[model samples]
Target: METFSSIECFVRSAEVGSFAEAARRLSLTPAAVGKSVAKLEARLGVRLFQRSTRSLTLTEAGQLFLREVGSSFNTIQNAVANLASAGGQPAGTLKVSMGTAFGRLFVVPLLGEFLRRYPAINPDWHFDNRQVDLIGQGFDAAIGGGFELPQGVVARKLTVAHRVLVASEGYLQNHAAITEPQDLAHHQGILIRSPQTGRVRSWQLTNRNREHSPLMLKARMTMSDSEADCAAAAQGLGIGLVSMPIAIPFLESGGLQRVLPDWYVDDGNISIYYAEHKLLPGKTRAFVDFIIEQFAEQGLAQRFSAV
Candidate 1:
């Protein structure tokens, strides 16, 4: 097995393009870095670098090897940092990006408690509908939905949210009916335009027998905000699809009523994602644990009936 010390020495040398620079960074002698690289090359049976009197360059094998092993190095670093930080008080900035509605409704309300628990943690939050590139944006983490996460990021599923098709009683009273998904094709559907992609949000629904299908409805009105969609639905404009939590308050107030109770859809899980790094900092770890604990306390899994 290749020693971690040797691998780290090689990585630093490759990054700095010189053994002398790498040794300086790692507080080792240039000869020590060179010896580590030689040992690594011998073990792998491949030349990683080609050295000239003036400069050093990676061999073709080295380029490929570094590409494959960079992430592994980062993971190792993060694991070490996480272990070291255990039981230590969190201190530093925790940068997070999240969707506007979720941030406003859920995350914002819980911020006070998190801050009170870890006063040493300073939070920098960005609320938007746009999907952020966490690494490029220098964010520690993000709250997101959907299945396609970017490469080199670790995604942890936090909670599943149910999407319910709802319409005001007044709207249903005037419309033909919405007993089935196909029936929505003829009715005036309030389309939700995603602020991130500028496309009308589509719905996935399952029937009483658990047969699921994606439905694209005809839209008479389109809005970017869920609150606006709910308002329009309440005014008898059309059927609006929204998360269960958002609809619950309105349902109890008699502003909206659930349609086709036997049918439902999943918006997928809310995930906390971060760049796959060698070491997770103290503040980031604290926030991640806090988020998980809060969700657990709220019975987040049970709320969506997620198994």
Candidate 2:
């Protein structure tokens, strides 16, 4: 019988088209992944992959085998995970992905309490600005805004991903007062370039009275991260469009002040995303529920909202 490790190595290598890339995702050395696949191929008595110096292509038989076992492995893992958590506390590596600044500011603060409550689970968190393949990349969960819901993944919303304009007191004092959205045209902008798109994002602000206005500002500087935008605005570089979660601390510290306070850009909701499995792992469920409960307790949803 082919071992689970060997099967996993073969499937991952097939999906990624290379042993080296599969090894990185599986947290194994390239040689180990290659050896595992070789073992599986030997047992099956067939060439699973047409391995070459530069590439690894799946053979016709390998493609058929992958189609049969690829999804089966995930199902088997989920079943095993469910069983493990059913008889005991949530135990294992809980892998998650989230936006760097938001995770540090909000989610990271909850780690101590979460760990105290569930010590058996070890967290493996990846923090970056872009969305991740929750299932394909083998993440237990992800937290962020504006993710396209892939098949078998669901999002539990946490808070409104609202962006509000902000500027330093010094900068505000020196520049023309911004009492309305149209006034932004006169000020310089510390803009955010979308990490996914690599294009400077444009905002359409909505006021309390269901009024909409386009954001027009002279581009003084551009950054790919919202945290950097806040920092630049705090330094009196220019007015910035900042997410409420990232701006909350700076606003409280008086480093940044809301410009046109009534107007905000609704990007969407920040959510905890997980696989839509019937037998969901306890760690994923626990983390998702805990985050929702904490956000509610802290009134984060209201605090992060502009309207």
Writing each residue's lDDT as its tens digit, candidate 2 over 1-307 gives: 3599899899888878899999998899999999999999898999999989999999999999999997788778777875685248887889999999999998999999999888888999999999998877889999999889998899999988999999999999998988877788999999899889999877788889878999897789899988999999999999999889999999999999999888999899999999987778878888888889999999999988988
Query: What TM-score, over all chains together, does every model reach?
Result: 0.70, 0.91
Q: Which 10 consecutive positions of candidate 1 have the poorest summed lDDT? A: 78-87
Point to the candidate with the largest lDDT: 2
- Score each candidate by Cα lDDT: 0.79, 0.89
Q: In model 1, which residue pairs have backbone atoms overlapping below 3 Å? A: 74-277, 74-278, 77-278, 77-279, 78-278, 78-279
Q: Candidate 1's residue-wise lDDT over 39-87, tens digit each?
A: 9999999999999987889999999999998778867856665555325
